[model samples]
Every structure is written in C-alpha cells, then in structure tokens.
Target: MQVGGKSQTTWQPLGWTGASGGGRVGERRWRLVDVAASAGISTQQVRNYLADGLLPPAGRTPSGYRMFTERHVRALAVARRMAEGHGWARTREVLAAVHRGELPAALAALDAGHAELDRERAEIARVLGAFETVLDSPAAAVPRRDARIGVVAAQVGVRTSQLRLWEQRGLLRPHRQRGTGYRVYDVAEWRAAQVVALLRRGGYPFDIITAVLDELRSTGRPDRVRAELARREQDLHARSLRRLRGSAALSDYLAETVPAGTH
Candidate 1:
C-alpha cells in the first residue's frame, strides 16, 4: 500500500506465501521512507538503528534509493516494540543484545528488570496513596495563624516556651496586630515552628538553628530547602540505623544472660 506519496507494505500474516509470484512467504516489502513514516519515528532514527546494527542492512532500488525488505521491516518493528514496551534505557541494552545474537536472553532480562521496576513503582504509589488519604482527612487540617501561641504549639506537638524562644531568637516571626495587641502566627510561622522543632530534636543549638532559619527565610528557594532537608534526612537515617544496631546488641547481651523462661 502507498499513502501520501510514500510506498508502504502491508504486514502479511506470519505464514503468508506470495501467490506463486516468486516472492517468499510473508514477504511484503516497502520503501525506507514509507516504513519510517508508518513507524511514527524520524527517518534519521531508522537510519541510526541501521547504523547501530539494530536493524539489518537495507537493499537498494534500481535508481539507488534505499528500499527495505520484509525482514528489515520486521527488525524495525521489533526495535520499536522494545523501545515502547520497555524504556529507552533498557531498549538500548536489548538492541545491543539483539545485535550480538543474544536476543532471547536480553528479552528475558528486560522482562525481569521491568517486573522489578513495576513492583517498586507500585509500592511507591501505594505509599503515596496512603499519604494522600491521610492528608485529605479532617484530622490533618491545616491550622490558621493568630489563634494562639499555645494552639500552634499544641498543633505542632511543641511547648509554648519553645515557640517563644524560637520567636525571640529570630528563628520565627509571627504576625502582630496593633489593634488586637496580639502576635498571630500564619502558616509560614507554623512551618518555621515545625523546622525549629525538628532542629531541636536533632540536637542543633539555638544559635545555629536561628542562623539556619534566617538564611533559609532570606533565600526562600525551594532547592536550598530540598538540599538541606535531604542532608538532614540522610544524617537522621544514619543515626537511627546506628541506634537500632546498638539496641540489637544490647538485646543480644540481655538474651545471653537472662533465662529464656524468665518472667
């Protein structure tokens, strides 16, 4: 078949035999341009596949134009299939394997790797879904500022005195209303309070904590915040692992001394 001035070949069934016209079984041939167009990829990509040894060499027409045989089309289709079914990263590996005559093994490896990635992605998605559910619940409501210092402290599971100390140290600045003669904290202040609580829990001194918060507030860049948080998380994770190992060692020591049936 030809469409839009490009010659195309209908992919015959697997066992199709040409009608005694000297063509091989399932041998519907097409021009390179047509195959590239039908494949929905650039002609350069097809050429790259051929150059990269993913596809077999193309035959030439009488006028010197490049023509593709049924086998070439099949190879291109396989490459496209791999690229679509798996990701580009794995597709390159699979294509290299195909070139090296280990296609079956490559495909099996791709399947296993894809299955593992899918499992991991599903687990992550499940955790995210659960987090979203909790976030949507009424118990997770975001509190408004200006209610009371104690209210903010209670909401964040911190003491009012700690919050006041943070405020005095310039780590947090709540809104002050002249008419009401009261300091009311908004969401930003609440977030600052949470940061201060985390820093205090992490054993950071009040002076260092104040400086960090000051720099963060002055910059207000999400990237800086993300990098800082990532570092903190890594440090906390390492500390927690060390604590867990220590606890396990203590438990083992106790198990060795105490009788198994002790009350």
Candidate 2:
C-alpha cells in the first residue's frame, strides 16, 4: 500500500504448491499497524521494541505515521525472537553481526554468535592497549607531581567519579592544599591512577584493584608491578573469552527455537 509519503508491502505465508507468496522482497514501506500485525504483536509492543533499541529508525509519513522497510521488518522479527525465545537483553549485538560481514543462512543465529565474539575481542584489545601504555611509560620520580582528575579521566576514558572513588579508597593519594583544599597529584600518582583505570575498565573489581595498588605502594618496583598487572590482565582476558563463548552458545540455541516472524 502506498501512503502519504511512503510505501508498504504485505507478507503472506509461502504456498504449499510453490505459487507466488503474498510477501514481496522489494516492499518499500509498512504502516505501524501493518508491521505489528505481520509480526504477530500489538502496536504498543512494537513501540516498546523501538524504545529499547531493538528496531532501527523508521521512515515517517507527512501525516506522522511510521513506515517500515523490509530490512526493518526482518530485523525486528529476529530481535523479537531472540528476546522472547533466547532471553537476549541486547538487540544491537544481533544487528551488528549482520552488518559486520556477509550474513550466513541462519542470519539471526549467526549474527548473535558473531556479535558476542566481536564485542569480547574489541574489549580485550582495548584493555590490552591500556596495559601496554601504562607498562611502557617511564615511572615519574616524584609520586604526587601532576595529577588532574578531569584530565586524567579524559585521557584514560574513565569517569571523573571513578577517579574520586579510587582516591577515597586510598588507591590514589593526590596532594591536597591545606587552606584551599584543592587536590593535586604528581606524575607518579597520575601514572598509577592511569594504570588503575585501565584495570578497572578491564573489569577488575574494587577489592582486586585495592590489593594490587597496595602491593605497588609498598614495593615501588616498576618492573615487578608491570609483570603483575600483565598477568592479571591475561587471566581476566581468558575468563572473559570463556564467558563470551558461553553467551554466544546460549544465544544461538535460543535463536533456533524463536518463532521466525515474532515482533
């Protein structure tokens, strides 16, 4: 059906005798109600899916109605299946996989697995890069020389609140002025905070971070500290890989059983 500023095509189940199916591959657009009916869901549910980022942005008519494309319909169907059948919380993962490379025969299932792996690999690479930067930089001689919370947080891609929390936990001790109460940290402290931020981003919990910080503070050996951090990062990477694999497998299984046309 062609409406105000868009077009739509309906999907009919394939015929047993191989006749022309009701659905057309090149269908250009769909109304909100049409999409909801085709996906066996309510219009409100469709809106909910869009709000949750499950569906991509749809074309809008001059009359203010949403118009969906074939791709959008297929994607929404896959996302609905994954969420309802496989318990997947994120739809972006499936969509990303589809966009990353050529999709396989079971597009939705393949996308789910690929997306999870891709995410983990990217995260691992980022953490490893941070680890390398910290280990390679020369340790500053003075411990509390030039730490700016905002600057350091921006440099390390962490939140300022995180830096403050680390300071409160004694993991970082930037110099404080007695009269004005301004916090200042030296080069060494700044480097230490950078290292802490790297590990925290790699998913290290507070307790482990505290323990590692304590060891570094007590010993003050750059080489030993670097080795310890590397070891911990490797260990965490392995654990993350295992979890990623498990999540992919679960998603694949769920995708298989999900109803194909569910919104």
The top-ranked prediction according to lDDT is 2
Q: What TM-score does model 2 achieve against the real structure?
A: 0.31
Question: lDDT per residue, candidate 1, 1-263, as tens digits?
Answer: 56899985333322323222212445567777877887788888888887776665555556677666665565666666555445455555655554443445455655665465455445434433332332343443356635668788887788888888778878889887679767778777776676667656656566656655664676576456446555655654554454344334323422432234430
Clashes of 1: 0
Q: Across residues 129-196, which tens digit of lDDT does each residue of candidate 2 receive?
A: 55455566554343344656777777666788887888888888888766877777677677678778
Candidate 2 — which residues are off by over 4 angstroms?
1-145, 225-263
Off-target runs (Cα >4 Å) in candidate 1 are: 1-43, 57-68, 116-121, 132-143, 146-154, 158-185, 188-263
- Cα lDDT for residue 37, model 1? 80
Scanning candidate 2 in windows of ten residues, the lowest lDDT window is 13-22
The TM-scores, one per candidate, come to: 0.39, 0.31
